[model samples]
Target chain A: MDRGGRMTAVVPTRATAPASGVRAAARIVAAPDGRGGTALPVLDGAGPLALRRTRAVAPGTAQVTVVGAMSAPLGGDHLSLDTRVRTGARLAVGSAAATVSLPGRCGRSATYDVRLTVDSDAELCWLPEPLIAAAGSDLAMTTRVDLAEGARLVLREELVLGRAGERPGRLVSRLTVRLDGRALLDQGLALGPGAPGWSGPAVLDRYRAVGQLLVVEPRFRDRPCQVAVLPSDPAEGEAMLTPLAGPAALVTALAEDALMVRRLLDAGRQAAAAAAG
Target chain B: MTITTTAPANRAALLVLADGRFPAGGHAHSGGAEAAVAAGRLYDATSLEAFCRGRLDTAGLVAAALAAAAAAGVDPLLLDEAADARTPSPALRATARKLGRQMMRAARACWPSPVLDALAAARPRGAHQPVVLGVTASAAGLGPLDAAHAAAYEAVSGPATAAVRLLSLDPFDATAVLARLAPDLDRVAQQAVDSARLALDSDVDALPAASAPLLEIAAERHAAWPVRLFAS
Candidate 1:
């Protein structure tokens, strides 16, 4: 599953998940082949996870889907993913469905980590489905992205604390993005009843769901990006938007439900598109 | 924790740095209290105490760690990047830099150190506020633990002072809230200094990254408020 100019030894042994849940890992590396085709130098998956590439929707762009067991991961489960877009290549990654995380036995938490890299002049758009943390669940996730000069990236993340009428679980999420070896955005949050900031008005404001969108590129930095506020009831939600250093912008929203959070993300996406153009 | 240093530590410098009237541009900002008041989540002394305690442990702890690292003579540029990574809200980042610039202006006039001048010349726009605080403390002959105390105190004091104005709550109550949290603040400062000592040996990334999402989100929302009393 490992390929390219440099040949690295691949560990063929796979770790199996327990009957309660699954521990999975995957890595995808895309490069431009001299033969005019997109070269997948690395495509590997373990446990119940699978990686699939769909037909390209545009020139130089390839779509990737994450296929996995539909059941929620059990407590103490770990999911890891790594992706790389080589020079001159474009990649769009999406998930087949939402990930539901269940509580681990004996108070153990599940974790997910994703590491992404984009070479110079490469583009990446990762729009994954919302993550639902079931009641009594404890989950932690971290995503780190490294971008070379001239790289373009659009990333979105959505989180729902729990299903309707259920109390939310604990969640700790972190995102670190860098451009040309300089930090662009570094953000981390701990939510749910156990976190100290969970009840603060400035954190979740008692909202059940939250979403964030980050757009980074040289073209979007100087341009003003405005986030549209949906005229919802005061008790429903609120949205915030700001431009960061190094041609980046972030839009965050908190809402009473998942659909409203999605709507907020759409507004941000539109604004990002407008800024990029 | 053993701190290997050549210079004697100035204990009195902590009081000067932690003073509310430090002219560091902190008076204009409420530490997200303005937005909380607008949202009706804060009203009386009870909720204010809760809010201050939360800020003390999360954002306050992180800031103290960063400041301690800076005072410990760790690279300022690296600490600045770590600050940027720990802070997620763009508006909050801008505010930190703005405050950092103001602090630099005051620190240069008070301490008059070559390091301060070099940092100002390099980051003309300003570095993160905690980073500047740490460097300023170092230049003042203060130890990393002293810087942590100042940072941890400021974290709760800023919000407590703001609540008095934003809610028209009794000034005595706000002051009392901070007084009650003195022991917890000491613990947080100690923890921050410990973490900073570890960071000096390993990576700056080892510093605490505790965050308040609503504080960041509210700062962004507050930035767009056309008629707000506070700057952030």
Candidate 2:
């Protein structure tokens, strides 16, 4: 059960989720707390799973980490993950470290799809470290969340262009996020080549960096941002976006009191400052 | 006791899903057509049709089913959460919520169903496009299958229609694209009806996983635009 039967130890297992390959995998670990809360289970030996010990961990700070590629991963082998935070549970899962790797060939990419569900009176935070797509590599990832009545979630994800010594321009990354059934957040980009928007005002504008965070909670509605950053809260959900600026267009909306101000910035510096807050 | 009138109730559900004016924020988005045009990936109706086809086969199909289910009296918020779990692109998810909000607005305006008000109250969860579509269709009295067809058609149409203004495609050709997709619309609609009957825990993995990578890339690239006209 190895490649061409040449190897014997790495056979794919039936216990794994369907469409899963050696490149990626995911699992859930949770046990109810004596008082009614629950503990998050570690995912596939990837690292420690983060769960709410009390109502103490701020909303936007949960994070988790999973190991990156070890050897040359083949096609059809991609990561799949799912997590559930039950009623009255609090959790934050962040990665231990950034993912690094030897870039794959052109036109090849690794895929990761994660599904998380939060129930009433529950809060979950996922602020994982950045993923480093090596030179000439392409990475495609999708993360989805389902929140029940009174549920809350805060998710943060980032990607670094080319790792270490590779030229930053040779990476391709695409990420999509959906809430409920309607397409909430969908974006994917392939860098390199004559990809029209390469230097255009309507595309990346030569920026090699991008980051996103989405928080869903009713409590987030009235909170105001002082400086660029908003502190994590238990009652509300917040999605704070930080663009590299770098000539790329910035589109954002922030609510103040009863009024919300949303504007686009032109320079990377201003965008960075705005993102920081 | 012979018969008074049931037209209003019969059409109530259909009105909820069919109206594009819903508060789901779909108006702010032109699908990827706006971004594709801005990126120059799309130049005319032909390319626009191709893009629509890809989306319909993947995201469009899912959104259609989810909405149709919601229309059939399923919980819109639950459907919204399920849809959210499926979308991976942060930007795309944001766009969906924006469109969802818009759909709600339209729904509240034209069809003030108690269910819609309840759904709206479940704010910040971001009512997805399909769930709202489903709930609205149910309120309108449209059959589940028919609702699915219309939902799919609209899902695909939104982007194709946007292409008209974004790429200078002849309106006639755009209409033709819509007309041509009729067969696909029916086929997918039937499939959705059948799939809806499956147990929630039934073999979802056995079903084909549909995804459109290129469109996703286009969306990501679209997010960074400095002066782009499209929201997603």
Candidate 3:
């Protein structure tokens, strides 16, 4: 199929050939259409990146769901997702399924870079499915968000070390969130192989699933969010909500499974939104 | 640190600055050991060593890098912001600043440098402890490596000492944990200096941002505890 001048196969095969891996960039741009709804001006997807406009529940929010057309981000593949939420607009980007990284013949690591931008008076909800790092696969994922003044953001990041009954490959994830030219949160977490002491008492401590929720609300400029320990659901492990130095608050949680982590983080998002209002 | 302040960097200065009894307000904090103990994650010497090892590599690496950057002559204000960007827990951030303020007082009195005084003036509430430690190291005529070593050592030593008190484990076992971690501390300090050198040439964003989420969550939980032996 011809996707924006690039010849990409509509349905990718499962041959797992390292040489045939495609490097692609997906783009999504959302803006208000002046009719009390949001518009998607640029929704281009190629290769394994399949971007589809989903039904957004909010009044003026546009939702885009990423559907992987192929079993990728295998080793040696380079993928990028670039998104922009224009002024007075809202965007929620999610994924259809969990992305599982696999080892390819190339024996090199894969890279996934996601860049999100929100303009003044705009909002972005970036909640994607968990990323599972399979055994023998190495991937480096980076997500950077740039928020203009008066912009609000709700971002969720979750990582599962490996599938059940298997060891995990090395996965390094870097998250940098900036608001109005100032940094809100910047953290690099390395798990599985190559990261010594990650599963020790002070770190994961036998927990395999980890996630966090970051809420950047301009309302926090006046009265800051109070730091509190999030009450854990009986199934979950531990979580906390702490106000950032900037106009943001973060909820960090660790659990035995991805479902529990997401539950804790979703509860955190509600608390943040309710507090902001 | 020495008889004269004009002399070359005194080795004892690092000893004094990094001393557990330096009155830097670190004694009240457990570096997450208290929470780990309360959670039963750390109840013995072996588990305590493992916990300290994790802290040394994640939080320890970041702290050492920030301190090294400061001691390398990077702007303290800029480093302070970088520290904030790396620290996600409000309780942890507050503890760092409070410790920074106390360290500032001690550093200004001991080293008496204009840089220390200026940083203290800029951050009245106080800067991050690592950044202040870097500046204090520079004031004492030490270098970035020295600052990194001090910070890295403190990362393990604080938890070890606290584990001794909290777990009531043998004191010698605690010191042995630190001794076994000496080689790891050296390696982390070296890596921190390299990162600091890179940041000095480029920007503070180049510093390490390694994070341990359990530590952050535990710290916040400990902060909210109705009654606790440790402040954080």
Best by TM-score: 3
Against the native complex, each candidate's DockQ, computed on alpha carbons, is 0.48, 0.05, 0.76
Q: Which stretches of candidate 2 lie over 4 Å from their true place?
A: A1-277, B1-28, B124-126, B199-209
lDDT of 2 by residue, B1-232 (tens): 0111123446545544555654455555777778667655567766666666666656666676676566555556656655654554456666777777777777677667888788888874557766766666655555566667767777677887787777778989988987888787777776665555451334222112243433444566577678776677
Give lDDT for model 1: 0.79
Off by over 4 Å in 1: A1-23, A33-37, A55-59, A70-72, A221-234, B1-9, B85-90
In CAPRI terms, where does candidate 2 land? incorrect
| B120-231 per-residue lDDT for model 3 (tens digits) | 8899999999999999998998888889999999999999999999989999999999999999999999899888888878887788888999899888878878999988
Can you rank all candidates by TM-score, best first? 3, 1, 2
Docking class of 1: acceptable
Candidate closest to the true structure, highest DockQ? 3
lDDT at residue B196 of model 3 (Cα atoms)? 86
Estimate the TM-score for candidate 3. 0.93
TM-score of chain B of each: 0.95, 0.83, 0.95
Clashing pairs for predicted structure model 1, backbone only: A75-A104, A186-B85, A202-B214, A202-B215, A203-B214, A221-A247
Per-residue CA lDDT of candidate 1, range A1-277, in tens? 1111122222212234464456678899988876655667787866545788877766668788776543545577788899999997888888776666667554678888889999998889898877777788888989889999889898988888876677888888888888998877776678886776566664676787888888887887567565344345557766666666567877777788777777777877777677678
> Model 3, A143-214: lDDT tens per residue?
989999999899999888876666887899999887887767899888898887899988898888889899
**Estimated TM-score for each candidate:** 0.88, 0.47, 0.93
Cα lDDT, model 3, residue B39:
86
DockQ of 2: 0.05
User: Lowest-scoring 10 consecutive residues by lDDT in candidate 2 chain A?
Assistant: A256-265
Write the residue-wise lDDT of candidate 1 on B27-73 in tens digits. Answer: 99898888878868788888888788778878898889999999998
